[model samples]
Structures are given as C-alpha cells and as structure tokens.
Target: MTKDQKDNLFLLVKSLTKSEKRQFKLYVGRLGVNQDSKFLSVFNVLDKMKVYSESLILKSTDVKKQQLANVKAHLYKQILISLKLNPSHQNIRSQIREQLDFASILYHKGLYKQSLKILDKAKELAIVNEEKNLAFEIVELEKIIEAQYITRSISNRADYLTVQAKELSELNVITSKLSNLSLQLYSIILKTGYVKNEEESKAVTKYFNDRLPKLELSKLGFREKLWLYKAHLWYSFLMQDFLNCYKYALKWVDLFYDNPKMINLNPVFFLKGNNYLLEALYFIKNKPKFINKLDEFYTVVNQSDFPKGENIEALVFLYGNFHKINQYFIDGSFEEGLLLIPQIETELIQFNNKIDAHHKMIFYYKFASLHFGAGNNQECINYLDKIISNKSLSMREDLLCFSRVLNLVAHYEAGLDYHLETLLRSTYKFLIKMNDLHEVQKEMIKFIRGLQDIYPQDIKKEFRKLLEVLKQYEDHPFERRAFLYLDIISWLESKIENKPVGQIVKNKYLEFYA
Candidate 1:
C-alpha cells in the first residue's frame, strides 16, 4: 500500500463510528481487493475495526445497540472467504470461528435465548472436534450469563417475599415466610454449585482429585471456583456457622494467593474483596483477635488499583460495606459509619452516570440507607424517591426497609403527618403477611416507641391495645423485649401527665423487680 493510502486507511478506521465501521468493511470488500497484497491491507483494516468495535460494545452506554450485528456479518463474510481459500485462517480455528459468528449475530439481535442455544450447539461441536479447551470457554461464558440471571431472579423474589411478609404482619397473621424464603434461597444456591455445604465441598474436592488427570487445568478457570468458595463463606455466615465461615474464607484467600492473576480480572477482584470483607465481619463477634488481619485486608483493597468500569464502582460500594462494618469493631462508635457517607456518595455519583438502571437503583438504595443512618433525613428521602420512581428497577426488601425507616423518622422528628400516615398504612399492610409474630411485634413496638416521645397519650392508648393483642402470641421470645419497651413507654406517659418523674421511675423498677 502507498504511504498516502495507508494513512487514509488508518484515518478511516480511526474516525468511523461503530455503524460506520461496518459500512467501511462493506466498502472495502467492493473495492475488489482480491490480490494478496490488497487483501492484506483490507485484513489489517478489518482487524483494527474489530478491536474498535469490541471496545465500543464493551464501553457503550446502550448495550442493546445493533453494532454487534454489523460486526458479526463482517466477520462471517471474512470467515466464508477464508474457508473458500483454505479450510481455516492461520490464526482462526474454523469450527470456533463459525460458532462465534453465529453467537455474535444472535446476541446482537437481542435474542439471548437463541444466542444461548447457538452457544450450546457450538459447545457440543467443540467437544466433537476435540476442542475441550474451547468447550470450556463456552461453558464459562454460559455460566457467567446464567449466574447473573439467577442472581437477579433471586434478589427479585427475596424482595417480593419480604414485602409480603411485612404486609401479612399488618393483618395480624402469623407468618414465618421470610425465614422460609431464606431457607429456600439457600437451597437454590447450594444446588446450583454457587454455594457448597460441607458434604458438597468434600464431594467437589474428591471429584477434582479424581478428574485432574483428564482435566486441563489451564482451561478450567479458577475464577468460577473462587466464586463458589466465596458464596459458601457467605452461606456459612448467614447460617451463623462460624467455623465453616472461617474455613471457607481461608479457602477463598488461598485461591487468590495461588493464582494472583485472579486480581487482574475485575470480577475476580470484586469477589475477592467481598469475601475478605465478609470474613472480617464474621470475626467481629467471635474472633476479635483477627481485627488486625481485617485492617490488613482493607489496606490491600485501598491500595489495589481498579480499571474504570461498572464493576469497579461496585467495588466501591462493597468497600463501603466493609468500612461500615469495620466501624462496629474498631470503636463501637457511629463516627466510622458517618465517615462512609462521603465515600459512598462519591461512588454513587460515579456509578449513577455510568451503569445500568438496575445498578443505579442498587446504589441509590445504599446511599439512602447510609444517609438515613447518618441523620441526613432529607438526603435519604431524595435518594429513596429516585429508587421508587425508577420503574425499571423492581421494589426489593432493602427498599422497603429504607422506606419504613424514613417514614418513621420523618413522622417523629419533622411531624410530617402525611408521611407518618403513609408509613403507618404501609407498615400495617406489610405486617399482615408476616407469620413471625415476634418480628411483627418488634416492628410494632418500635413504631409505638418512636411515637411515645412525641405523642405520649396517643401512643400509650395505642400501645395498650397492641399489647393486649400481642399477649395472645406470648410464645414469641421477643415479646419479653416488647414488654420491656412498653414499660418504658408507660413510664414516659405518666411523666408526661405531670406525675412525679421519681414515681414513674420507681414504677418501672418495681415492674422489673416484680
């Protein structure tokens, strides 16, 4: 190629937008570049176009764009030409090439179901072609997509169940639905290999040992296993099985140490950081000796550099969770919790402008929660409003929790009667679906307790009615705590009525003493 022609080609490749790049490829083909030298020039341009297109798709704001379809067509045409000239290109495996083109086309067409079907067929072809390594790659991609879908589904369902449980509580129906939902969720994670129990862990170890001879370790990526390990640790923590939490956490750390390259990938780094933070929190109550280790983990995370992406912003929120928990152990003070607000706010803005609607909702919820905890009620209300108004993001348990807390705070402090009435109605609706009488009573007591400080006479009358109903469900252990709170409220009520404060105090002491 002449220098001028080469420069022109470079500029064309560089300047073309994603759609225009596809047009450029078609234009190049029409130029009759059949000679070896001419074809070489066209191939270089196509290669550069591929790189540019891939980067655009990866970084694009609109993931649903049709840019991939054009690229897929271009790749398919090139592959067809290469196959006609020779069975395969020097660098491309014909079998892999064909499957990828098909998959890419299907993906771009917004037919993920069809795309996954093509990928499964391609996986079978890879196996038949004795391309086990390629098959593994296809498997990993399939799992990544499947796992994300499953996680989203699980989150949505959990949110629904939480809201239902709350609604049931208001109807005064005993419901253990949330606990049952949690158990079912744990079962799903266990069965999917996303989480492992002790039996499952042992079975997995034995299977790997037996299959190592046949398995290509290079192709059997470690990141998937690390994810499972981290999930197992979380499962253990949720179950309050501390030993298992410690064991699985150590296994997760070992995986990172054994393959430091895991950190080079964004997903792996996020998972690693998450697992480390979970471990640190697990040790807070039982293994206080590990506080220094937890600090070390935080230090490593703060120093580790992250490339700009949605996942990096996710890491920021995960770090926020870490810092929030660390405050609990470090000094048992709210200062550490306050310190995380600015960090979370900064990261929320970073994500708000970049990530998908789902992620934006997640960050908004976090920001709202942190603001509420920090006594920034108006800021919390603003963030909560954003989440509620986003139709694309479904309401979840976390959102309900924030809404309930915000409403209660607004009613008590700001005397926002409208918000208070809304909250009362919402909480009553939520409680109707709950079977756990204890939790229901606790929530009710909290509501009344808040009211006691502001409207003692009205709250006292309401509490008397609630306590009478709760006495019918006195089997709940938390009922005792509710009574204690009620006693405190009664004392405040008498004091508000101008009875001597000492008389109220003595009555509370006599009640406890008796």
Candidate 2:
C-alpha cells in the first residue's frame, strides 16, 4: 500500500469507538476461518499499537513482509464493510442507494415487475427527502423497466416518467450550478484569504454573478436555497463586507431552522452556518446578536434527536469550542477564556487525528491571542511558537501571515526586543513573498524597527503617531482586514493609555457597541 493509504488505515482504526472495534471483530469472526485469518491478526496487532509500524507487525504477527500490503488492504476494506453495516451509518441516503442496488440486481434477473415496484417506492422516498439526483436515477431505471413490458398503464406511465425525468434533471442542474459556485468561492478563499484590491474584487464578483442561477427564490427547494446562501456568504467574506456576511450567514442558518429535518440530514452545514454567522457578528461587533445566536446553536446541538457518531462528535467539539473561545476575544475577556484551555487542550490532543492541520493551527492562534490579551506575554509566545514552527503551507496565507505578525508583537511585549529585529526582518520578508504586504503591515513593521532609536519619553508619542496612521486604515477598503487578524488599533490604544489590553477592548465594547 502507498504511504497515504497506510496512514488512512491506521487513522481509521484509531478513529473507531470501543463498540465499533468490537463490532468489527465480531463481523470478521462470523466465519470460522476469520478467527485465525491473516487480516484479523494484522488488525489485532494494529489495534494494540499506538502508531503504525511495519517492522512491529512483522515481529508480532505471522504475516510476512511480502504479504503485508495485501493484508493491510484487506483489513481496510473489511473494516469499512463492517462500518457500513452499523445502524448509525445507515442514513437515508444509504438506504436509497441500497434500494437502487437491489432494484438493479432484480432487473438483471428479468424480474421487471418486481424491479419497477421497488423503484417506485424508492423514487417516492427520494422525492420526499429532496434527493433529486437519486430520484432521477430511480426514474431512469423505471423507464428502462417499463420499456421491457407491455402494460395497461404503459401510455400514461411513459409520459409520467418522461416528465419526471425532465423536471428532476432541471432541479439537479440548478443544485449542481449552485453547489459548483459555492465550492469555487470556498476554494478561492482557501488559496487567497480575501480579495486584496478592486481588480480581485471585480473578478470574484463577476465570477459569482456569472455563475449564480437566475431562478425565482420562492420556487427553489431547501437544497437550492441552502447553497445560494452559502455562495453569498463566501462572496461577502471575500469582499470584506461583514454586515453582508452576517446577512447571508443568518439566512443560511435560518434555512436549516426553517427546514427542521435538514438539520438532522445535514448537520455539518448547520454547524458551519452558525459558525460563520457568529464570525460575521464578531467582525461587525454585534455582541448581543452573537450571544443570542450562539445560544441557539447550542440548543439545537444539545437536542436528543441530534445525530451521534464519532465524526459528528468530533465536529461538535471543534465548532463548539472554537466559537466559545472566540467569544472571549470578542469581549476581550482573555483571562476567562484561558480557564477553558486545559480541558480544550486535552480534548484537542484526543481529537488530533479527527481534526485537520488547518483547524489545529487556528486553535493555537486563538490560544495565543487569548494569552496575549490577558497580559501573559510569555504564555502567548509559547502558543504562537506552535503555529510559527508548523511546516504545512496549505493553510490560508493570511492566517500564516498574521501568525508571524502576532509573534513579533508578542515578543516585543515580552521584553524580548533583542530578538524582535531579526523576527521583524523575517516577518517582513515573508509577507513580501506572500504578496500580503499591505499598508497596515508596512506601518506596523516600520514603527517596530524604528523603536530602538526613540527615547523612552518619546515612545508614547510615537505610539500616538502610529495609532493615527493605523486608524485611518481601520475602515480602509483593503487595509481593514489587517485588524481582523490582530486588533492593532486596540493594542495600540492600550499601550498609549498604559492599561491592560483586555481593559481597553472591554471598554470599547461596553462604551459604544454594547
């Protein structure tokens, strides 16, 4: 097996719950030969291991080096089959696919009547569940079966099936177009954090406008509406239009709420929609709305009918805690947020494989920001190092760029100025290479580099001057995104006032916004 496939097998094994592991063993042991099966033996060795090791497998099992790859491949397929049999994994979509498979088998046996009957029932279920793609397939299968026989209802049946096919094909086309637009927008954000200038903004706006389907909103189904809101959300995010982000994100979450069953069918979207809504609220500084919406999110998640399983469990923990920490940043109550770090860190380690590298790095950045706001400069630096030293470059460039910028700030605040110049030089060079050298970054770097020459009494004077320059761009078109990564304006005000940074932020919220 290739290295990625090998790691996938190991990760899959690690992801299984205790019951799932036991179920797999029972599934394999159903046959007497499986008790002493080579794959089972390999699985046993892997299950006992904390990490994958081919040498350890050879040392522990009777399986030879030459047969290891095949054995691992067999074990991987068998485990998935076992998982497929689990009741928790058998969702409505799987049920539809299963029925389609059965219908196909019956059709091959020339059981035309039986196949049509099954297809009819499956088609009804698919239509009722808004599974347009599957419904179209079921209709096509019905058409084929009908063509094989002469029936009393043949004339009526043929017309009905033809119309069904055309209608479903159209609905699927709309969904496909919307989903495609949403995905392309998401891909652009991952590659380039946001539009940096009018040219990029026009490109994104044109792309969105050109691809967006022009259907009456009232005529669209739940799925179509959901994707429409998501596309707009991403567009607003890229445009740095927080209020519009909030608007679409609210509509996204409301779509799920309005279609209560979709919440169960598509929990990932539900979780993400709420997260984005909260993120937008944070950007727009709407504390009251953010608090209310977050409460609503938890209420929905904590319900008895909410889906359960390892994957859902991991997602719930990740999104729930991410916004939980972000709330502190929103309010500048960093120390209170720090109280949850120990438990969150423990869970993060437990969920290390379940969560991806991007999310883990994001978590570290939030932790570092919390510590920085709480006046624990050294603790903040420790967390920042975790992000700075990471090797992966696939994360958003803006995220990576801000990690270094925040690191420079943390080091300077910690009285580690001896290291700041080298760090500042590296950060500037890194941003230039990333094509992310905005005015805010340049000004911040310029001020930090010139700090060594300024007299002690003149430091606050320079802070005031720097604050004036940054404030101008606090609402500037392309420059404001810098504040999103780090609230430089707030930090500067805190320094000028000689107060705790959190105090500065808390005062801002309570005074004007709150």
lDDT of each: 0.47, 0.89
lDDT of 2 by residue, 263-313 (tens): 888889898998899899888877788889889988988999999877788
| Clash totals, every prediction | 21, 0
The CA lDDT at 54 in model 1 is: 38
Question: What lDDT score is found at residue 397 in candidate 2?
Answer: 86
Each candidate: RMSD: 18.1, 1.8
Please name the candidate that would achieve the greatest TM-score relative to the true structure.
2
* TM-score, model 2 to reference: 0.97
Cα displacement (angstroms), candidate 1, residue 313, comes to: 6.0
